[model samples]
Target: MIRFICCLILLSISTLVSAEEKLLHADFRHRPPEMIVENNRAAGPLKDVLDEAADVIGYKIEWRIAPFARSLKGLKNGKVDLVPRVIKTSQREKFIDFLGPIGHRQKDIVFLVRKGKEKTINDYHDLYKFEIGIKRDTAYFTKFDADQALHKILLLDDRNMSSMFAAHRFDVMVVLDKDSIESAFKQKDFTDYAYADYKHKQNIGIFYGLSKLSANTKVNAELSRILLDMSQSGRVAQIYQNYKLEAPLRLF
Candidate 1:
C-alpha cells in the first residue's frame, strides 16, 4: 500500500510538470534608449514586460532576433511560440489566439511632406490630390485599397518610397508614426520632412500573440489569470518602472 501511494504522488507531480512545459519564444528588435540586448537576453521595456509575464506564468522563454517579416512567418509556422507584440485582427484569428493585450495603441501611420510646403493631405479626398507612399502587402495599404477615397495612393518599397518623397516624386508619403519620428531624428536631410498627424488614424492594441501550437485552452486561461493578478498586484507596474516605460495606462 505504501509503494502504491508513493507511485500515485509521483504520477501527479509528473502531470503537473508536463502541463507546465517549456512553451514561450520571443522576438527582438532595436527600439533604442528603450530596449537593447547584447545576445538573447533582454535589456529594455519590451523585455521587462515579457520577463514579468513569463515569471507570473512559471514558463520559460527562448529568444530569436529576426526581421519583422521573418518573425511573422516564424509565428505563423509555429517556429515561434510567442510574438511579443502584434495588432489583433479578424484575419489572424483563423490561425492563432491572442492571450491578452498589454500595450497601448501607439502604432499609427502618418502622412509626411516637406516641412514648409503645403503638401500634407488630411482626408481621403486630400489624399487623392498627390501620390502617397504606402508599403506593399501591409494591412494599412490593404485598407487604403479598399477605401474609395484613396484610389490614387501609390505603393512603393521603402527605398523608392522614401527617395521619391525626397525627390518630390510624390507630394506626400505615409509612414508609421514611430518609424517616421525615429528616422527624422536619425537622418539630417529628412529633417525637412514633417508628418501631419491626422491622415491615417489607427488604434492598434499590442497583444501577446500566441501560435496555434500553443493554443491549449488550459494554458491560455492560466496565462490570463496570471496577467490579471499581476495587474492587480502592481507587478506589471513594477516591470514597466524597471524599464522606464510609462506604467501601464490601465491595470485592467
Candidate 2:
C-alpha cells in the first residue's frame, strides 16, 4: 500500500511539471507559403523556424487567431507574445521588439484585379475609381496606408477571400503573398485574375515582433541569438526551402 501511494505521488508531480511548462502565445492568421494553417495547426516557413528556435530555448507556443489590428494591440498591451511577418513601422517599433527580417517587404505584396480590370489600376492614383478589399489593421506601405481618399472595405482575417472575389465583393485584393492568392485562384478556377501594375519594390523585410509585456521578453536575447544563428547556419533557409520559398539574405 505504501509503494502504491508513492507511485501516485510521483505521477502527481509529473503532471504538475507538465502543467507548469512555459508557453509563449503567438498570433496565427493564415497566409500561405510564409504562414499556413494545416489541419488546424500552424505551418509554413515562418512558424517552422520560430518553432525550432523556441524549442531550443525550452519554450512551447500557444497560437491564437485575431484580427491584424487586435494582434498588434495584443502585442502592444502584452496580451499576445509574438507576431510574425510584421514590418518595422515607427509607431509599432515603440511597443514591439523585432527579432529580424525574414523576407523582403515588397517581395510579396501584390494587388489583384478581375479579368480586364487590370488595365484600370495601372497606378496608385487610379485606386480611387473603386472600392478595394483590404484586411483590417494591415500596413501595406507608408503612402498607401496613410491615404485617406481611397475607398477600402475593411475585411476580417477569417473571411473567404476567394469566394468574396468571385462574388465581386470588391474591385481589388491587396495580398501579402503572391503564392497565397495564386493558390486560391487555382482552387476556385478563377485563374483569369491579373496583377495591378503599381510597382512597389521596397527591399526591406517583415519580422517576428515579440510582445513587450510577455514573459518571452526575458529570453529576448537568447531567442534572437538562436534566430541569428539559424539564419546564418542555413536552417532558416532550409525551413523556407521546405515551403519552396527563398529566405531573406539581409537579416541585420
Candidate 3:
C-alpha cells in the first residue's frame, strides 16, 4: 500500500508538470529596431516586450523566421500561434486577434527621400512626380497602398531599398521611422537620405496578434494584463531605451 501511494503521488506530479508546459510558436520577418532574429534568437525592443510577456505568462516560445506573407499564412492555417508585430487590418482581423500596441503608442510610415529632394515632396500629390520604392509585402497606409498613379518599385527588404535609392534607382523609399531607415542606411553606408515628413502622414499603432484558429481567451487576457502592467511600469520604455531609441509614445 505504501508503494502504491508513492506511485500515485509521482503520477500526479508528472501530470502537473506536463500540463504546465505549454509550447507556443511565433513567426516574424526581419524588421530592425523592432523585430530582428539572429541565429534563431529574437532581439530588439518589440521582441523584448514579447519575451517579457511570455515569461510572465509561463510559455515556451518557439520562434520562426519567414517572409511576412508566409508568416501571415501560417497564422491563418493554425501553424503559428503568434506574430510579434502586425499593423491591424480588417483582412488580418479575420485570421488573428490583436492584443496590445506591444511596444510603443504610435508608429509612423514615412517617405525617405534623398536629402536635397525633401523640399520637392510637399504632399501626396507631389509624390506622383517621383519613383517610390516600397518593401515587398508591406502595407504602408490605405491610401498609399491604393494609389495606382504613383510609380512604385518593390524591393525585397530595407537593405535593397536603401541600396537602390542610393544608386538613384528610386526617388523615394517608403520606410518606417528612425528604427528602420537609420538601420538600413547605416548598413549600406548611405547617409544622404532624409525623411519627407510632409508627404506621408500615417501614424498607426503596432500590435501582437494571436491566431484566431488557435484562440485562447484566458491566455489572451493574461497576456494583455501583463503587457499593460509593463507599459505602465516603464518596462516597455526601458526596452526601447536599451536600443538607444526614443521612448515610444504611450497611449495608456
Candidate 4:
C-alpha cells in the first residue's frame, strides 16, 4: 500500500506541473505555398515561428485552421487564443493582444489584370474608371472602400478574388505587393504585370490574440518578454529563415 501510494503521489505531482503551463491557440487563413495545408497539417513561415515561440515559452499550442472569416470569429468569441499574423487596426484592438510584427509596411497595392490591359492602370486616379477587387471587411479594404473618391468596387473572398484575376474576369485587382508577388510565385509564374500606387501605407503587425481574461494584462506582459528575448537573440530570424521567410519586420 505504501509503494502504490507513492507512485500515485508522483503522478499527481506531474499532472499538477503540466496544468500550470500555458496554452496558446494559433490560427491563419492564407493558402499555400505561403500558408499551405498538406496531409492534414499547416506549414509555412508563420506556423514555423508560432511552433518555436510556443516551445520557447514552455507552452503547448492548440492550432486552429480555417477560412479568414471563421478564424476571425474564433478570435472574437474567445474560441481561440492566438492568431499568428494580423494587421493591427484600431477596431481590432478591442479583441486581441499582439506580439512582434512578422511583416512590413506594404506601401502600395499591385494591380494585376489580363495580359494585354497593362497600360490601363497608370495611377490611383485611374482606379475610378476600373472595377477593382477588394476583400470585404478587411481593415485595408474597409478603409479603401470608405473613401468616396475611389468608386466601382467589386468585393470577393480572397480565393475567389484571386481566381477572378487569373481568369481575366476583372480589369484590375488591388492586392498587397508582397502577397501579389507571393501568389504569382506560388503559381510558378514570375512575370510582372500592371501595378499602381495606393497612397495609404499600412503597418502590419503579426501578434498573438490572447483571450480576454481578468489576467490578460499580466498574460500580455509575460508573452511580450518571451517575444523580446526571441527577437534579441535571433531566434525569431532563425525560425523564419527555416521556413524561407524574410526576417520579420520590427514594429515594437
Candidate 5:
C-alpha cells in the first residue's frame, strides 16, 4: 500500500513538471525560406531548428511577427526572448547574449540594380550617382556604413526594401546577401533586377540571440551548448536542406 502511494505521488510530480514547460517568445520578420511569418505562426526551417532545440531544452515558443527594426529593438528591451538570426556587432554584444554561441559566417555583400543597369556601378565613386536602399540599423561593409555622402533610403524590412526596389523607387539597392535578393521578388520579377558589375567584399556574422533582460536568459549556456552541438554535427545543414536550402556557411 505504501509503495502504491509513492508511485502515485511520483506520477503526479511528473505531470506537474510536464505541464509547466516554459514558453519562449521568438520573433521574426517575414523572410521566406528562412523564416516565414504565416497565420501569425513561425513556419520555416529556421523555426524548425529552434523547435528542435526548444524541445530538447524543455520549452515551447510563442512566435511573434514584427518589423525588422522592432524585432531588433524588442530583442534588446525584453519584448522578445529569442531571435533566430541577428547580425553580431560590438554594440549588440552588450545587450544580447549570442548563443549557440556567436557563430560567424562569411557572405558577399552585393549591390543590386535594375536589369540592364549592372554596368553603371563600375567603381566605388559611381555608387554616389544614385539613391541607395539599405536596411535600417543593419551593418553593411565598413566604408559604406560610415560614409555620410551616400543618399541612402532607410527601409524597415526585407519585403518593404524589396517592394521599393522592384518599383524602381531607388536606383541602386544593396542586399543583405544572395537569398535576400533572390527571394525579394517573385520569379517572374527576376528580369527586373541584376547584380552590379562592381563588388565590395565583406563577411557578416549571425547568431541566435537571447535578450540579456529576458527571464529565460538563464538558459543561455544550456541552449548554446545544444545549438553548438547541432551546428557541429551537420544537423543545421540538414534543417536547411529540408527546405531545399543550404545552411549559412560558418567561418568559425
Candidate 6:
C-alpha cells in the first residue's frame, strides 16, 4: 500500500508540472514611461498592459534585458519568443509576427535640442547643417533615413545618446517623442532641453513582436483576443492613465 501511494503521488506531481503553461520569453530596453526595467523587473504602462494580458491568457513572461540589435538576433535565432517594444518593418516581418499596437499612443520622432537651438531646426532641410545624434540601428522615419546629406552621429542606445547630447557633444538628438525627452531628462537630472517639431513627423506604431518559429499560433491568437478585449473594456486606457500617459487612440 505504501509503494502504491508513493507512485500515485509522483504521477500527480508530474501531471501538474506538465499541465503548467509554457514560459514565454521577451526582451526589452530601458525605455521609460513605456517600458522601464529596475532591479531586474519591468514596469511602465505598456508592461502593465502586457502583464494583464498574460494573466488573462494564462501564461508566464520571462523578460530579459538586451540591446535592440541583440534582441533582434535572439528573435531570429529562436532564442527569444517576443520583443515587447518593436516597430514593424518589411525586413522585420520576415522573422517576427507582430501581435498588436501595444503602446497607448503613436510616437512622433522629433529632434531634441538645447532650448536656444529650436529655431535653427525649423525643417528637415535645416537639420543638414547640424551634427545630429541618433540611436544606432533605429529607424526615425523614411525621410530621415533616406537623406544622405545630413550629418549623423550614431550612438549605441538612448541613455548613451542622451548623455552625449547633455554634454553638448552633438547639436541635436532625435528621439521618439516628448515622453522620451522627459524620461531622458529625468534620468540625467537635466531639463534644459526642448523638442523641435518639424514637417517630417513619423507616427510610429509600437508592437509586440512574436518570433515566427517559437511563438505558438494558438497561444498568440488567445493573447490577441485578450488584448483586444482589454482595449475595448478600457483596461488598456486605465493602465496608461495610471502611469500619467496619454491613452492611445481607441481602435475598436
Clashes of each: 0, 0, 0, 1, 0, 1
Residue lDDT tens for model 4, 49-111: 666766766777677667666666777787766766666666777876776654454444466
Q: Best candidate, lDDT-wise?
A: 5
lDDT of 2 by residue, 1-252 (tens): 999999999999999999879899999766776787767777778888888899998898888765577888899899899988887888788888888655454464578888777678777788888788887777778887888898888776424666787788777888766776677678777776788877565666657899878766997888878887888788888888887887777445
Q: Could you list the CA RMSD of all candidates, in the order they appear?
A: 6.3, 3.1, 4.0, 4.4, 4.8, 2.9
lDDT of 1: 0.62
lDDT at residue 234 of model 6 (Cα atoms)? 83
Q: Give the distance in Å from residue 169's predicted Cα in candidate 1 to where it truly belongs.
A: 6.1
> Which digits, one per residue and each the tens of the lDDT, describe model 1 over residues 1-252?
999999999999999998877657777654443456455555666566676677666766677775456666766887776765555777777666676656455456667777865445655567777666665434563476577666444553454566656666766766754553455345545556776645666666556667775543346667756665666677767877876767545525
What TM-score should be assigned to candidate 4?
0.74
Candidate 1: where are CA atoms >4 Å away?
Answer: 1-23, 31-42, 106-108, 136-145, 148-171, 179-189, 214-218
Q: What lDDT tens digits, residue by residue, belong to model 3 across residues 1-252?
A: 999999999999999999998777888766775677678776788777887798888887777787777877877887888887787888778888888865444456777887887777777788888888997767778888888998999887766777788899978888754676578778777789787857555556667888888745457778877877887789988988999977667765
Q: Locate the minimum summed-lDDT window of 10 residues in model 2.
A: 100-109
Instruction: Tell me the lDDT of candidate 5.
Output: 0.80
209 Cα displacement, candidate 6 (Å)? 1.2
**Candidate 4 colliding pairs, count:** 1
Off by more than 4 A, model 2? 1-20, 65-70, 102-108
Task: Select the stronger candidate by TM-score from 3 and 5.
Answer: 5
Candidate 6 matches the true fold with a TM-score of 0.84
Q: How high is each candidate's TM-score?
A: 0.71, 0.83, 0.79, 0.74, 0.82, 0.84
Query: What local lDDT score does residue 49 receive in model 2, on the 0 to 100 scale?
Result: 80
The CA lDDT at 213 in model 3 is 82
Residue pairs that clash (backbone atoms under 3 angstroms), model 4: 99-207
